[model samples]
Target chain A: MDRNLRAMASAAQERGLALRPHAKTHKCLEIARRQIELGAAGLTVATVSEAEVFADGGFDDLFIAYPIWPSPGRAERLRRLAGQVALRVGIDSVESAEALATAVGPLDVLVEVDSGHHRSGVRPADAAALIEAASKAGHSVRGIFTFPGHSYAPGAPEQAALDEARAMVDAGPHAEVRSGGSTPTARLAGTGPVNEIRPGVYVLNDAQQIELGTCDWADVALTVHATVVSRSGNRAIVDAGSKVLGADRLAWATGFGRLPEFPGARIVAQSEHHATIEFGDEAPPARGDILRVAPNHVCNTVNLADDLIVFSGGEPVDRWRVAARGANT
Target chain B: MDRNLRAMASAAQERGLALRPHAKTHKCLEIARRQIELGAAGLTVATVSEAEVFADGGFDDLFIAYPIWPSPGRAERLRRLAGQVALRVGIDSVESAEALATAVGPLDVLVEVDSGHHRSGVRPADAAALIEAASKAGHSVRGIFTFPGHSYAPGAPEQAALDEARAMVDAGPHAEVRSGGSTPTARLAGTGPVNEIRPGVYVLNDAQQIELGTCDWADVALTVHATVVSRSGNRAIVDAGSKVLGADRLAWATGFGRLPEFPGARIVAQSEHHATIEFGDEAPPARGDILRVAPNHVCNTVNLADDLIVFSGGEPVDRWRVAARGANT
Candidate 1:
């Protein structure tokens, strides 16, 4: 995990961009502190609850990367969190920006520009309106942030980065800190546009990362240690299931998950407690044999886990509690 | 949740079968106690951790529905759990049965039959072999059990129930307790062969249940209360996303989730903290509007949530902690 953190931090440094690795990927305070120690500018989170955790954990700067619907309770917590850290939140609409600006005191708001993943965020051209509204409503406009989520596909990183650059350039005049991210487009995203990147999955590269060619097998830092309980012909049933590996099936994902050890083997299906694997050329694993499975997505999988058995030098060395695992209000 | 519990219990009583609703759906000790109060025969869990949580919480007569891969840690826990209650576990393969028998000590085991899901379990015709193996391993053979998971899709419940009955009948001679389950096929499942059912989702029907015509809007016991943060013409963004609603998009699911208020509006996509909704009506939700979102899969959604705001008579009467939320090992 430290190797992944250093590699991503170094990559951002080489490209002259500040690394603000998304904390939603790991949700562990120890990992977040390690990332900051390795030169992360600030931590990026998805919720106010996550911000609260990292804030309580003593991390100074935090950014809620999603356009939050600040309720009365959330706004109150946001104000409390902001007082403790250099807190920034994403705002995509004029209504939300104005409401947040009035409900919460003194926040650094970023215009969320939709870089093509139509999931959230405002249009790049229309970001100026939200930015202006937020600025007028007593919030500091911090340029823009765009999530190139479309880069998750097999061969779409370059195009997603181009989209991110275009969106960042469009919001460049509004303010200062232009942020763009997505692990797949993290390297390409620093293309003369964004000053900060918030790629989360790069810290614990998964099967999706391997499939996208973003990381090699050795680059994967997190893996679910599973024991084979049953074997029938070429089929082996492992203890790890969707509850452990997570139920994230990308369009191009080969199976439920990937086995780095046996590349030919596919995690064919998963129950809540059992993952059925179709063994490749290698002989079927004996009962009680442990194997590592790289899940389809790291963030959701981390949320499901209680603590991570940190392995070093091929031995279990340390354990880190997933402190912010359930910090999803 | 009370309504769902009553309706399911009543339905099972009418069929003269015991309703052992799977606790994996809610994973709340409070809810499990309520189910027991409502005359539920027992509780069904998916993992050893869940079993441990419930056993500690004082719920007896527990069944680990999945064919668990009993590792050393899990075996030790299972043995401890069994000593406290009338415990039973599913066994599909001979190897797992023998291992579990030797590892966990004397326990009641059910030969799991593949009804129609094909995800886990031995074939109906071959269930006898597994039953025989468990009996030989000093484990008491407790009939058969089948998960009609295939019933989750539209127009599949009736056939899945038929398969369930056939499988139960095939394993009749080897055991005493015949169990069949699934919310979609619960009523259809008590077709004479099964004496008990384990319909978990029926206690908190989700979008998939609504789509499958297994339940209606009024039957939905749980909902994600989300506030609209942004609006773009007919499109509205809600605060609840995969983090709260869960990322469970079935092949037959029409959207990421369903809005009970506007049935026609589709939850087009979801990120970690934002759900993008494209309204089917002319009137769209404004910022600060809270809407109830019925998740795609209630079990996973429940697993993500920390606590549930139990509403009665359109008022928040109780706040139940999801004590067993992350009890997935």
Candidate 2:
């Protein structure tokens, strides 16, 4: 984890870009503090509750990087969080920008420009109205931000990053504090006018990263320690599944997860409590054998774990609580 | 929820089978207590921590339904829990059966038989060997249990139930307390030799259930209250995604989730924090509109939340903590 954090931090630093690592991945205060100590400029979050957790944990700079709807309950929390942190929030529409302006007090806002994911964010051509609305509502507009979420595809990282840059170019004057970066496309961030990069999964490269060729096997820093509970022919059942590993397998991915020890094996399927791994004709791991399995997506996987059993040199170390777990409002 | 509980409870009662609802669905103490009050024999859990949670919540009878690995840490916890509750664990192989017998104190165990899901559990023909191993290790073999997981398909419920029964029959004389049931196949559960049913998702039917014709729109008891955060053309973004709604779209299931408020809409894509619902160029819901979304899988969805906002008569009624939210070992 430290190696991953240092590598990403140095890469962003060399590119002269601000490194605001997304805290939504680990959600651990110790890891967040370590990231900051290793030169992360700030922490990026996805919800007001996550911001509040970091603020309560003594983090002063926090950004909620989602096109958040400022509901009454969330508005009150955002209002309180703005009083404690150097807060930044994102919005993709005029109405939502106005709602957030009325909810959170004196915060910097980023117009969400769509780069290709098509899940949220405004089209580059539609960023003006929301930027104007956020500015008129007594909030400071800090330029545009987009998420290159489409980079999760096997060989689409380069194209997705280029798409992000083209989206920014299409939104000409709104490119000052442009921020964009997914773990799969982090290397291509500085190729555009992006001044800030927010990469969450770089702290814990997962199966998706390895499958995307974004990271090698040695780069994966986190894995689920699963125990083999049953064996039938070549199928080995491990006591870890969607509940522990998270269910974010992209359609093109290999399987449910990846086992570093048994690289030839494929986690064919997952129930709530067990992952079915097929080792083909090879002798399956003996029942009661422990294996380290990497989840498809580390962010959601970390959210599922209550705490992480930190390991060093193949030995157990400290434990870090997932403090912001289930802080999704 | 009350109606769902009563309906499923009465269905099992009329079939002369014991109902031990899987708590992995709701993960709420209030719901588990109400199910017990409605005549559920016991509660079924997926992890040792989950069993501990129920036992701590004053529920005496519990079953860990997965082919559990008896690790040192988990064995210690299981030993502690065996002293407090009527515990039953499932095993599918001689190695795991003997390991579990040596780990926990004298307790009943069920040999897991595969019922066409092929994810976990041994073949029904292989159950005798595991049963004998458990019996020789001083553990009581209660019977055989199989999860009819394939019932989640659009019209496969009846066949899954039949397969469950056939698998039990193949297990010969070890079918004393044959157990099986899934949300979609609950109605067809007792058509064969199953004397006990463990249906979890019937407590809150989801999009998979609705798509499978297991339940209708009105039967869905749980829905994510999401706010429309962004709108563009016909696409509306809601503040709920895999982090809240869970990412469990079966190959034959609906998009991501089901929105009853707009029958024509389908959630096309999901980011970590937003679900993009396309409303067919109908200008979408205005920003800040709250809508209830029935997730593709309710069990994993409930595991993602810290607490549930209960509703009755279209108003907020109570709040319940998801007691076993992250009890994944």
The parts of candidate 1 lying over 4 Å away from their true place are: A280-283
Measured by lDDT, the strongest candidate is 2
Q: Model 1 chain A — which ten-residue stretch has the worst lDDT?
A: A167-176
Please tell me the TM-score of chain B in candidate 2 relative to the true structure's chain B.
Answer: 0.97
Worst 10 residues of 1 chain B by lDDT: B167-176
Q: Which ranges in model 2 have alpha carbons more than 4 Å from their true place?
A: A173-175
Q: Each predicted complex: what DockQ? A: 0.60, 0.76
Deviation of model 2 at A1, angstroms: 1.4
**In lDDT terms, how accurate is model 2?**
0.86
| Model 2 CAPRI rating | medium
Tens-place lDDT digits, model 2, residues A18-103: 88999999999999999999888899999888898999999999889988887888888888888888888887877777777666
